[model samples]
Target: MDLQVLDFPGGKVAFTSKMQFISETSEKRVPCYRVLDDYGQQIEYDCSAQVNEELAVKMYTDMVTLQIMDAIFYEAQRQGRISFYLTSMGEEAINIASAAALTNDDIVLPQYREQGVLLWRGFTVQEFANQCFGNKVDYGKGRQMPIHYGSNKHNYFTVSSPIGTQLPQAVGAAYSLKMDKKSACVAAYFGDGGTSEGDFHAGLNFAAVMEAPVIFFCRNNGWAISTHTREQFRSDGIVVRGQAYGIRSIRVDGNDALAVYSAVREAREMAIKDQRPILIEALTYRVGHHSTSDDSTKYRSMDEIEYWKMSRNPVNRFRKWVERNMWWDDKREVELRNDIRNQVLRAIQTAEKCEKPPLSDLFRDVYDTLPSNLHEQESQLRETIKSYPKDYPLDVPV
Candidate 1:
């Protein structure tokens, strides 16, 4: 019996198809592709693509919702209403479409930028508001910052600040799911920058060796913070990382909502039915800063951002497809945007007025039994709050 080794770095496999196949002893596996060009036309892939009016409209609505939320939250941060914010300005399709393909039982391990997924997964606007504003109603209390929303109901893991950590966690979760003989899988989302981390490799290798059901979804938006993909890696893309793990992988146009949805739908099917871990590299671009904290202008030019905006706008491309199919109207689009904006504004206003989580709420969840040292520190902090001036925001009952 002979085993095939793919030398991705040495250029042994000819990178022609969405997936390259090697003649391993007996079994054969293949990759899937569905990419579209700037004109909303298929470019690199030519498989039988399927999308209908309902899915198209749903995708459009999700994209619009994400855009509206992103725009408002950025302004909220600017107005000092929120401590931190992250936007999925350009990568809307990659997040929402991929999420649209998952089951309610499937777990989603998302990085900070995939706020769109939660919203699409029945996370009400008010829940988003509560989480972002860190109001009394917030599930995590006031611990996580804006957009770090999670829900057990949705099977979406909480978004953590550390990069690439979710990859391994997703692998472990999938391992558990498989051990329990469940059909559900875990889809972990990460950025191209995260691909450089050791966690990415460890997670992929574990999933591959264990045959865990997980989807390693990478949004190759060309930048990892201020660094470009060329700087982060020299391989074909994040997809090749999947090849190294001997996992089935796909690459799609991240801006094309249909392609993204179709690719993920197929990937999810493979994951659940075959217990295969998949790596999907969505070739997209980040049209915004690394976050509200960093100025992209420091590292990239205005011209570059403008280039992606005009030519590769996911919203615009999807809108074009919508118009071409006559499933959407310009007047309705305007009205929808206005309605969403007003909805967000009202949610924000209500969330802002909601009481902050009780000062003691923070000390409750840390341990089964609080250590004396931590209890003392918590007490000292409470005392300091009690010592604040009457006008201070500290409303704890001392």
Candidate 2:
């Protein structure tokens, strides 16, 4: 194959062109775009509710419910009722509003913390408890970890534990949707930390080149498990990377529900109509510990967390907006908090009482037909259980 030299208006490139060159234009900082201010109030421009009153109320209600659910579940993990857990503490708006902006048919590839997306799509509190508890009713049949949730009916993919694997998977799924001539698009959610992974680059490049209808939603919550965004990347956050890959992108106030909703709504439309990828970098903070395994205070200050909690809480900001609109009241707020608390407690109790997945489930779902090796292993396990029935009560065949 012959290598051809290409000439352009400002520059010429050839196989022998030196890779090292300084471009002052590329070094400029890109401004973060936002539609709403810290108070959930529209800033320079107005973006009215894209949804009607009923849907608007529902979105607000879900955000409050999600906050309550996170409180209870985090407590459950501390009490050792569940093995582990992750909460969408400060990113509720980014989760719920973004979900509200998409149709039910759109696919969601979530990182572990975006449980609000699943909940907004009608995943019941009981179902969440079931999965976290790894009970018989869990859709994963107790196979996945506590926060790894998925629903085919809801068009949400099962979350993988690997950090950046979902980015490529979302691109592939969007490509399939394009090939099928479907109107839907795929949304993949990841944190700022995921940008450090190789898959993020490959996925974005492929999506842009192939014109896959997908949204790469990066929740830049300023921390990737205690490593702050400053140390994560030297670029102007994740948004500039999208421009580098020739993908349209935006940055939004992640704490402002209205801003996030508006940004995602437009992104979805452009993605479906233009058959291209869009990147969203949601600027927010993580108010809670990264997970049950982490102690956030070890690295971050209580004063910093308190500042975000008091000044930029997404739930409180959205609540204030709803209150100003006369769509919510103090009495309703009290009622909602109490109602969600009771529901969460009830679901936790029910899930804890449910039986664990049967021992046979371990061998099932691996393949269409159980391999001879697995069958032999299953038989050996059963015999061992039979020999120590009391010690293996949960493994006893029903």
Candidate 3:
């Protein structure tokens, strides 16, 4: 079929009968963009240290701290101390390095695993324990599930469990920032499985058309729960979808801290200066189970998990890079790990001992003035607790 044309008041519209498609064969052959190798050595181009020695060491330190924190908290969940938890594990570089590239003022809307971002922004280990235990000190007042962390003080939005919802929210926030002439951009993180959602398409399209200053960081970590990437999509991963929406995109070696840091730094510049969205597909593997409830051995081979864990450990790779730069050593590594483990353990104990939120907290935040029905319910609950103090000893007075 040949081209067809139609004339309109503003301009002529042309259409072609030819169908352009990215077939599975072509997608399989698409090359992933990578800067650093498994050993943290440059692959092709030199990605020299843009940050000084202190910042470089700090990034590596945070990654190790995250690793240790995840291990301890994951054990806590298994030991029945916490209800649930998710670990950054193999993707620490993707979390901390990209975070290192952003300023404190930049807004971060993260998926659950990007807790390292908040940690880098100074969200303390104790706050993590508080949220996990859902104690009175938790910022959400024991309202949110464990691991769904947020901090307005750090400009990080609270994580929502419903996948892909944050994409549009990030774009909307970015649009508002653009209108307000703010100097910061928004960075939203989601998994590869999130790309399958309608919200992902809607968010990307809206951001592209509106030229919103947002970065869509997709952590293509091999598995979406039990479903592998091969079963998830037939295209050349999530990065290609960005191009389909006329947005600039790149795929980076997610395990390599330098690669992730460099790509995100450039992406932030493009997003803020150009007022456009950028998609980053970080090619990494999820070495741990999806969450505490998940048993990955049921779906994946232990051998494959061990391979990624031993060979592509992001923390080890970055540590090697920093050590090569003469800024880190085994003594510092030991001291940091010991300190983090002790801190996490102490925080967990403290959070558990803290009291639960008062019953009134539930009715307080929903409305300015309490509704009659809720008021009655609150009163009845209080009366019941007052009458049966033995049965409701933990319940606090309104």
Candidate 4:
């Protein structure tokens, strides 16, 4: 899985032979690996070995579920049910395919938009709703905002608000696993926008030097909020950065679910066997806005979004594959989608009806034993709430 290439213009450093400077973009760039064409037909190579009917159906269904979940939740935010929301639209393959490749033991450090990974690991739709609604049932205990989900049982780290913070954390976790002789590796996921952060470079360098088994998975969907990736950097993309850090790297077609699955599966093997870091830059698009807070039309054209949705959607592409293989039909599609929608609506209703976490949770979860300062603050808070009872909702247990 490791790609060997020259570091400089020449094979080795020469005193006077053909001096050259790095170009903004190179003609000879890293190639993107694709297993299927736009029609979901195999592109020369047979992908059945990498993705069979059973696995393909699961991946497709999971991706569809993710699509339905994101849409319904995004709408819920707009309708004032949730505070905020973000989506992995046009990047579903990057989520579920890569997730399917890894074992349950692999620790996940995710950026905000990798919900499909959580779904594949058995984090139920109700769990998603619980976290988004910030209900008492959420494992995070309503401490964080919507979608900042975590689960110790799933071995997935809770997502944070800060960009690129997970990169370093993933590296440290991988190093710990290495030193402890654990069989598992770490999958650190971030977006192209995160590459600009200093943490990205530091994490890659640390993992490379320490020979930690970690995979740096970048969903390069061409935008970080409002800034396009081209403006974010001038290099050929994220793959070349791995070369600079002495890490094995590959660029995969993020829309092609088979390619993503195979690339990540093999990458994991190489990372664990060699005890070295690997980088995968999954090229895709962001058809939806950055989040419920953003209107993508301000920066990108509606035509462009429509083109990707119609011509290059990962979900549609996978559905085509299943249809061609005789494993799917219109009836199944209709039933599956309608059921997912109903389940998501039910989840939202249940989550909304659940009580919010107790007011004491704000101070109780952070420490083993409550400090005197926190105790005093809690006391003051209780006293204030008691005096001004009407101002604070009584339903929120004091």
Please report the candidate that would top lDDT against the real structure.
4
Query: lDDT tens digits, residues 1-398, model 3?
Result: 32476666956788767888746555254466666577767567654437678888999889988999999999999999999999988999999999999999889998788999999999999999999988888899888889999899999999889999999999999999999998899999999999999989989999999999999999999999999998999888888787789999988889988888988999999899999999999989999899998999999999999999999888888887788789999998889999999999999999999988888887877889899999999999889878887887463434
Worst 10 residues of 4 by lDDT: 1-10
Model 3 is weakest, by summed lDDT over 10 consecutive residues, at 22-31
Q: Mind giving the per-residue lDDT tens digits that candidate 2 earns over 65-152?
A: 9999999999999999999999999999999999999999899999888999999999999999999999889999999889989999
Stretches off by above 4 angstroms in model 1 are 1-32, 41-49, 389-392, 395-398
* Candidate 2 residue 87 C-alpha distance from true site, Å: 0.6
TM-score of candidate 3 versus the correct structure, residues matched by position:
0.93
Stretches of candidate 4 exceeding 4 Å from the true structure: 1-18, 22-24, 46-49
Q: C-alpha displacement of 378 in model 4, angstroms?
A: 0.9
Against the true structure, whose TM-score is highest?
Answer: 4
With a 3 Å backbone cut-off (N, CA, C), the pairs that clash in candidate 4 are: none
Q: Is candidate 3 or 4 superior in lDDT?
A: 4
Give the Å error, residue 89, model 4: 0.8
Report the CA-based lDDT of candidate 1 relative to the real structure. 0.84
lDDT of 4 by residue, 1-398 (tens): 22343357645442544678867666888899998899999777744346788998899999999999999999999999999999999999999999999999999999988999999999999999999998999999988999899999999999999999999889899999999888889999999999999999999999999899999999999989899987999888999999889999999999999899989998889889899999999999998898888999999888989999889999999889889999999999999999999999999999999999999898985789899999999999999988999999755778
Candidate 1: TM-score?
Answer: 0.88
Which residue runs of candidate 2 sit more than 4 Å off their true CA positions? 1-28, 44-49, 393-398
Against the true structure, candidate 4 reaches a TM-score of: 0.95
